[model samples]
Target: MATEATEIEITTIGRRTGEGHSHPVWFIREGKSTFLLPVGGRGSQWFRNLRNNPTIKLGATSAKAKLITDQAKVGQVMDEFSSKYGAADVQRYYPGVDVAVEVRDS
Candidate 1:
């Protein structure tokens, strides 16, 4: 299935342009929800776009995205990412782990 893949494509509407922007991002699927970590934390362009519009498309599936800023909750998600992608890799790629995005199945 798509969820089992290493990465998934997500499309978010541009915060300033109001146009669709797509990017391939690493994700972890837990039950009915998918979690994503911005490589640049909250400074990521896609993440900023999410702040303007929480709606996103995961591959062909449309879903609502929620920004997770709570440190405890973000830590839990980071743990999951570490377990799946390995601790060393997650740290190397995601240096600024200040926030996370949660996308629910739609």
Candidate 2:
């Protein structure tokens, strides 16, 4: 049961370099699913990495990851983020970005 305030480390394989890249990011968990929002949007490097490989490391846990571009689903996930972090904070940190990463059992 990960709280929304919890920051988790995510590692992705670099698309070009083929190296493991790790970064700390905010997460929202619902049941067994975990969601990540890229503050930097689609152009973000980690987002690219996840695109290159759906497999990602969430701290000690390994999960399959996928980019979520559907507007409705993205909005739902954003709502979860907003609910946890507050709308103001989420807007401040994730301005103009609708992209997200969804993690589930690999």
Candidate 3:
């Protein structure tokens, strides 16, 4: 993964349609894991899709996703995002920080 890139395209299977859907999302990489924050938290369409199917694609890289709902863990992921994307920008763009997604290499 390219650490310098600010954003990456994530492809997920639609919960209802069972079809592929791709969207640009901001992410932060730490060691072997990648963290992502849904713009609308658990309510985001992508997040909901992941709940049904954890499989995903970060650009061309296939991966598995785990939803981080624990408050403490989500906070840590949020902090990482703030550190990388700037606090102001994160706060402005991500209003609902109730959940996070952790992506690991497959």
Candidate 4:
């Protein structure tokens, strides 16, 4: 069977409220790692929450997230997203966005 590598359910702890928050979002899986990007970039609520806390749930898996600030890595992830989901879709959903979330095995 093929791997399902498109979207994932991410559960994050709310920074202010201290409650669980879930969001279904597009993801990129490469080997043992996964990556995510906010459609609206760094100003997004989830991103803000993640900044406050890196621990998160990726589907049924517990993972630690690192915000990818390296310009080259961010560009590469963006390219991978464009290739997997198509440029038009990326443009439609994520315009002028460069930040990325790298979710590692925990």
Candidate 5:
């Protein structure tokens, strides 16, 4: 069976140093578009780097430096994220947070 994009966990890169960071982010794919939810908020380096260079290493089994971003389509992806990761407060200090990131699957 082909690997389902939904089943993959993308490993995003850091802003300053291109290091790898893994998080259980929700990914919804349509055509060539993939969406992500950065629950960590401002502390989420993945979101910072992606927004800067839009390049990341998507790692589920292996790794690939693919491009990602955020957009209106995030609402759709956030729905899936809330379903899988649940709508519970992902962060403690900041409640009711719904930050997300949109990326291209590598």
Candidate 6:
């Protein structure tokens, strides 16, 4: 949730085409790492694309296209994201749907 409105960028892969897609998201930093909580949950195109392939491009002012995944790091990721973005927004994401979270390398 700690952001500067500087246009945090994240590129996700297309599940079927092996293509790359980019999105300007609110990239949040916590401690020494960073995370991106899809506000739309698994149903999100970006989230679904990520589920298909954990590898994607993560960038801020600088770009570090890396392979990221959802591997049981949700609690920590949620903590940081919720701390800044507020538990309401993150929780509201797919409310009653049990959303997913992941850490992206920056």
Instruction: Choose the strongest candidate by lDDT.
Output: 3
* Weakest lDDT window of 10 consecutive positions for candidate 5: 62-71
Please state the error at residue 81 of candidate 4 in Å.
Answer: 0.5
lDDT of 4 by residue, 9-106 (tens): 89999999999899999988777778898887888889889999987898888778899878798888889899899989988999877699998765
Score candidate 1 by lDDT. 0.92
Q: In model 6, which regions exceed 4 Å deviation? A: 1-7, 60-79, 86-97, 104-106
TM-score of 6: 0.60
Q: How do the residues 1-106 of candidate 1 rate in per-residue lDDT, one tens digit apiece?
A: 3656889999999998999999999999898889999999999999999999998998988888999999998999999999999999999999978999998876
Model 2 ranges off by over 4 Å? none
Which residue pairs come into collision in candidate 3?
none
RMSD of every candidate to native, in Å, equals 1.0, 1.4, 0.8, 1.7, 4.8, 4.3
What is the descending lDDT order? 3, 1, 2, 4, 6, 5
User: Each model's TM-score, in the order given?
Assistant: 0.95, 0.91, 0.96, 0.91, 0.54, 0.60
Worst 10 residues of 6 by lDDT: 60-69
Highest TM-score model number = 3
Q: Count the backbone clashes (under 3 Å) in each candidate.
A: 0, 0, 0, 0, 1, 0
lDDT per model vs. reference: 0.92, 0.86, 0.93, 0.85, 0.52, 0.60
Model 3, range 1-106, lDDT digits (tens) per residue? 7888999999999999999999999999988899999999999999999999999999998888999999899899889988999999999999877999999865
RMSD (Cα, Å) of candidate 4? 1.7
Q: Give the per-residue lDDT digits (tens) of candidate 5, residues 11-72.
A: 66676776766665446555664555555553567766666666554554433333333444
Which residue window of length 10 is worst by lDDT in model 4? 1-10
lDDT of 3 at 26: 96
Candidates ranked by TM-score: 3, 1, 4, 2, 6, 5
Model 6 score (lDDT): 0.60
Model 4 has an lDDT value of: 0.85
Which pairs in model 4 have colliding backbones?
Answer: none
